[model samples]
Target: MSLRWKISATVAAVSVVVAVALSLIVHLAYARKQADDAHRLQAERIQLLLREYHRGSQPAFGSRLDDPAVPADLRAAVRGGKVATALRQTSEGTFIWAAAGTGDHVLSLRSDYRDSLGDLAALDRVLLLGSAAVVAGGTLAGIAIGARLSDRLRRAATAARHVSAGDPTVRVGAAIGGRSHDEATELAHAVDAMAGALQARLEAERRVTADIAHELRTPLTGLTTAAELLPPGRMTDIVQERTKALRALVEDVLEVARLDTATERPALSDVALGEFTTHRAAALAPDARVVVRVGTVVATDPRRLERILANLLTNATRHGRPPITVVVDGPRVTVRDRGPGFPGHLLRDGPARFRKGGDRTTPGHGLGLTIAAGQAAVLGARLTFANPREGGALATLDLAPAAGGEPSP
Candidate 1:
């Protein structure tokens, strides 16, 4: 049943019970009062009989009792004119019933008469009708209350669901009643407060990330092209080094952009990590030392995989004194640097794009670790940064194998 009806039914039921109990009490009391009146009226007869007997006129009055052997004490007492309170006998002169009372209250019971039971049934019928009326009235009142409450609750629930699904514009329609006591109204206010905070955070982050990307990309592109055009023989190592830094900056910006926008989720596939590493090593780190420890397979997109490795290799070249070893085991790939270890906190946030490099002492934009970390996340992998006991930072990407696939290795 609807909430309104259910609440009304409960209220009605309780009212009915209480009403019936009260009615029964009233009826019982009324019946007892009636019996008392009957007893008082019968007491008149006893007084009259005592007066006559005391005058020596009705001496054999005790012989008519149902218990023909009336109690000797009572008979003697009645025989005397000094009877204080005498027992009553039925007017037929047979002791069918008796009672003793001085006023309106019946204090004693009679053996043969249930003087009140007959009237009790009539009172009971009246009590039943009164109870029904009370229940019906209570039910109507309860329904009104339940409906008001349910309406407010339903409005709050609807607003909550809307906000949960990311529609910040949805609002609770009207006040349930007064602001002083409306719980749903208060809840709606709370939701509005919370939504405003979330929206602000999201907008601020979006604006900042976009502005930073715009500021960095133009100069980076120019620097990369100019470096490439310079005669390597004349510029020597300078051109290569400058171009590498510029390229790293550009890549980092792109990684941030891609991850920030939800448009590029990876197309997962089972690719053998060992095989993928072999291709990457051949293309980028051909002359550099490299090793694969296991033949594990991981699920990921190839293009995103290359981006992940490229950042790792670039970071190693820039800061890690590598001799890099790339290995695969189970569902993971380890990119180890045999260089001076990561500066304490790099492992914590995995690398934020602009926060690294630029100190004359450190060579590249801190973007390398950041880019790798972001891409790894997008492709369903966790990049763990750990300091090996031996030395350097060991970065691992734990990946999941594709569904319904073989070990590609």
Candidate 2:
């Protein structure tokens, strides 16, 4: 259940319990008071009868008493010149009897209180219904309040998710009910501040990286030219190799900067995924295996797709064992390599720019998978890396479906 429903239910349950308890207490007290008043009135009537008999006025006994069913103990007490009262419950219902002595006879009176009992029963039903109404009103009020609060929380949660998914512009404004100083508003402001800080820091880093790469490109070109002019020797070969490595690193850094700023837009078009993957694999690495299970076309940027595939194939060849396999099923592509699999940290957190995997002594600068992930994001696809239980590294890219069109045959 949602938090709104849970809160509403709790409030409603408590209201019902309190209403019922209060109603029961009031009804019990009223019933007791009614019984006490009936007894007192009965005793008063009996006293008046005894007084009348003593004065020899002799009022009719049946006028003040009904049935006059007196218990033995009560009759003896009245005959002994003491006033007595008794409550009896017989097959005919409840009665209150009071008696007192006047000369040799006991002046006794009895009252059938079944009508008063009926009134109490009617009052009980009223109280029960009133309590139910009270409970229902409270429940509705609780639901309204809970729904409003949960809506505010849901908006805040959505903003947090957008921030997590690399959109820094999303902000969870003020609280839904417009309270300025509440906890929900405070939380929203905190999240906005955090997102702003992260965006600023990341942009600053990207600027620095892009500037450094741009500065190195000129020197790197000159260095390569100078190495080519050198005499053929071991030193020239070493210089050429180092220059090539530096050039590759600079290019990767520039690409990462571009991805960070999202300066590239996908030129989406329907492309046959199976044929495309086969051609790219043949050109990039003819030795690798390619398999098409469900050959369906997808709408995507062809250049970006090739970049993604190239990175995955290169990583497989460089870091993993042979028998690299590429499989396409609908808008999903899976690349599996028989290797030691990904490191634990990479599997958990995905790829980070310049974060190298495998042995530290490896030649590549570790931006291949990062570039692939960035390109996939640009094409509206999800790229996931995992070490399958079958003991190999698996990279799956799930692309968006073709735009309002069936897959090409």
Query: In lDDT terms, which candidate is top?
Result: 2
| Root-mean-square deviation (CA) per prediction | 10.1, 3.0
Tell me the number of clashing residue pairs for each predicted model.
2, 0
lDDT string, candidate 1, 1-409, tens digits: 8887889889988998899789978987896676666556555655554445447643334412223444445444443232223234455442323322222222222333444555677778878888888898998899888888787777777776776544556765443344555666677677777877876786578667677867777877787777777775857567778767666565566567666554457887778777787888678776555566566667788888888888777777677776787776756777787887776767665576667633447766566677677677778678878879999768787887766545433
> Each model's C-alpha lDDT?
0.66, 0.85
Candidate 1 wrongly placed segments (more than 4 Å) = 1-202, 208-244, 287-293, 357-360
C-alpha RMSD in Å of predicted model 2 compared with the true structure? 3.0
lDDT value for candidate 1? 0.66
When summed lDDT is taken over every stretch of 10 residues in candidate 2, the lowest stretch is 59-68
lDDT of 2 by residue, 1-409 (tens): 9989998999899999999899889989998898889878888888777777677756556534223567787878776677878888888889888888766667777788898889999998999889989889999998998898789999889878877778755777732447656778888888888888888998999899999999999999999999989999999999999998899999999999999997689999988888999999999989889888777778999999999999999988888888899988878899989998988878888887767775888668889999999999999899999998888789999988776645543
Model 1 / residue 33 / CA error / Å: 32
Q: Which ten contiguous residues of candidate 1 have the minimum total lDDT?
A: 100-109
| TM-score, candidate number 2 | 0.89
